[model samples]
Target: MKLELPQRDVGLADDFSRSEPLRYLNLFRLTLAGLFLVAGPSLHLGSDSPTIFFGVSFAYVAAVLSFGFPDAARLLGHNRLVTVQVLVDVTSLTLIMWASGGYRSGIPILILIALAGAGLVGQGRMVLFYAAYATVAVLLENMFRLLSGRETVDFFTVGITCIGFFAIAQVARLLALRAIANENLARQRGVDLASQLRLNRQIIQDMQDGVLVVGEGGVVRQFNPQAVALLGAELREGATLGEHAPALERELRRRAEHGDSAHSLRADGSGKMLLARFLPAGEANETLVYLEDFDRIHRQIQQVKLAALGRLTASIAHEIRNPLASVYQAAELLREEKRGDMQARLIRIIGNNAQRIDRLVADVLALGRRDEALPEALPLAEFVDEFIEEFDVAESGARGVVVNRVPPGLEMAMDRAHLRQILWNLVGNARRHCSGAPAAVKIDAALRDDGRVALDVSDDGPGIAEALRAQVFEPFFTTHSKGTGLGLYISRELAEANGAVLELCVTPPAEAGTTAALPGAHFRIIGRVKP
Candidate 1:
């Protein structure tokens, strides 16, 4: 997964070929030209030909000023412009050297400086060309001095000066090559770091659990969308964690002070429980906070249990089912024959216990198939009416017991069979607990503010104790002797398979001007509204 970086106008030797060194070289040339114009006459610096020396110095100043303009490099191209400037510098300095008494003058030092500048800023072997060019100019000046009947030409001094030019050029070229290599290495490392940063950010954003990077003072330095969702707060960089989620911040502080590893809290907005774990981020006073949804964690554990139980119960049910059916059939046959009351009662008990075992087996089998849900849009009002009619027929004593308060046109997205099974469990539980009166069980459906549909089932009977509320949905937990205790557990599993939540809650108050509300147990299923 290679990330494409934005394009840049980078070059191979940008560090060496930049215009900064050229500007500094031009500044040096302009200063040397000014010194010649101002001090040459008083110090007898240009005794050979003072007029020509001053003329060349003035022209050198003018050329250096022209090179300072920003557009000069663009108009003539960078390399060509630098080449032209170095040529001007060499020619002007050589002319000044000739007019200022040949090799005796110190102008050759300025020529050496210009050569070194060209080597440092110019591209490739152009430095050698400038060095050779300056050598030819020096040799021609010595020839001119001898032909004009002036003085003897010193060949040794001229050769030594020319050698110095090439030596300086070679040193500058080596330095520039090393500098460019280092610059290229640094740029490649920067690109690699940027690529890794983008890839890591994408992975964090897609994670199911929330992740937060907290620095000193509980300030949030970085967070993903899941962090915001789990905390149910609007998080931003640099915001103090205490301001958005005080409970979480407190737990983090407690863990830091006491070294406790276990802690949980409820989200402020959704009221969903979250388990928090903290780990060192390998920085000074920095922590990595991971917030996991407790319900989601439970579902994962349940799925693992269901997988193992499915395989175990499958083999056991097959074996027990055959003998159990034989026993049930024999008891039924015995009941048909003439028998005493005690014998009849024993046979009846055998048949009833056999049926309970069968129902429990069927419920266990349903748990294995919880993941096979095919969700679709369902009309809430019509579905409730059909469920109520069916329930009235199935449980004769519960006729006219369940009332549907679902508004018209309200729809939900859920698996048809799963939803039916969940409602059957909830309504059957409500029927057993509610008073034997009309409209004792109320089924209400409404759209929540978060765009999810809420289906509530409540009754008018004694509600469950607060201490036992948490155990209502656990497998194999029930108050009735004949109950399988898998009804609510399977219902919750099926609800989760369809991306919904089923939980027990406080029963809602009855309508104003209607009968007073009851204190029975309430169950709600919140799921996505039909698109």
Candidate 2:
């Protein structure tokens, strides 16, 4: 996985180190300056020492003003300005040390404090520079005091003090470097965490199953788009879940108290059988609910069952066909051998029954291979003209087949074999049932508003009853006693495999002035027009 770190703030570590330590340094300066006024007399400093104290106090007041005004710091710019301030501090402390009697006074410790502040400025070279400068000044003062006979200096004390200043500077610089590294690691971690959160949200939003997180009192804390669609309600965050889906909210709340549970229930209005699963989430009274449409699952299972049945029958059908062909040949030979009238009639019946059985076997074998359909564009006008001509030749003396005018240049995407099989079933059914003499059955085509072409096969017989409309597409449903009953079902399956629909259409209502156009059975094949 790729990690994208957040952008680092420019100079954040440097600015932080520079400003933070300066605040403390200013406080130290003020406190030390106050101590000089309060304890100068006890140390027995002469009047000249007071002048030095006053000067240091005045310099500190200017430092206080600089700290209070942001623009002053911006004008001086941190590095150059801080360097000047540190120099002032070193010079002031040296003077204070001298006035307080050199090595005898404990004020030299303030020089060490300055060195520590320099380390917090995040500049290692500057710290060393200041430390060396302070060391030289101290040594010079000690030498001057000793040589001028002002006071005796302890060389060991001066040497130890210089070492202490450099030590403090080195240790502080190491800590500053470590702090900056920690800050960078923490910033990168925050960026990765945010990226992971957004990725998880996208995955949840795109899920097919509905997901919901309901908090206390049935308030919807979080929900995905699928939840809104599956529930058939618009779910806004922070809205009470009970308002949109009361049954689901109640089920979730009940399961939250009673441990993990799953319920299969039908949603009202939508009539979708849903499998709802609830699990406890986080702390307190919260639950995660998952909703899935059980009807879709049932359909998938049914399709698998149908496919298995098709495979089993395919093997059985091939074996049965060979025996059936032998039986049909025997019946035809027996009729030709001039048996008695009753025996001849029985042979004809046997022949007809064998033919019907052969037809059924062929349909069953076709079912096993119905899933594959290689489609191509077929121009509707030309296809229909060729089909009617071939159908008339196949039907031999049958009459009254008429084709209505179709839209020009209309085309359909379909497998030629599949489309021919479906149209043959529809036209055959219409021809077998049609009652009229001159125009018993008809074929027509039109363009529908939803970007599909509708090819209609209608007859002039009584239309199917309203109660039987829903079952017309079902397998093994037939009105004819001699029919195999798999014709419409196989046709529909083939149509669907080719990205088309075969459905019953309502016959147009008769006009008040005429009984010439009576109701009839109408079926339509709806399919996409090829680009």
For model 1, the superposed segments whose C-alpha errors exceed 4 Å read 1-17, 41-44, 149-153, 281-284, 311-531
Whole-model lDDT per candidate? 0.84, 0.75
C-alpha lDDT (0 to 100) for residue 368 of candidate 1:
73
Q: Estimate each model's TM-score.
A: 0.55, 0.53
Q: Which stretches of candidate 2 lie over 4 Å from their true place?
A: 1-18, 34-48, 234-239, 268-271, 296-531
Give one digit per residue, the lDDT tens place, for model 1 in 5-55. Answer: 223323324644466777787778778778878887875677888889888
Candidate 2 differs from the real structure by a C-alpha RMSD in angstroms, to one decimal, of 22.9
Q: Which RMSD does model 1 reach against the true structure?
A: 20.6
What overall lDDT, based on C-alpha atoms, would model 1 receive against the true structure? 0.84
Q: How many clashes show up per model?
A: 0, 0
Show the colliding residue pairs in model 1. Answer: none
Top candidate by lDDT:
1
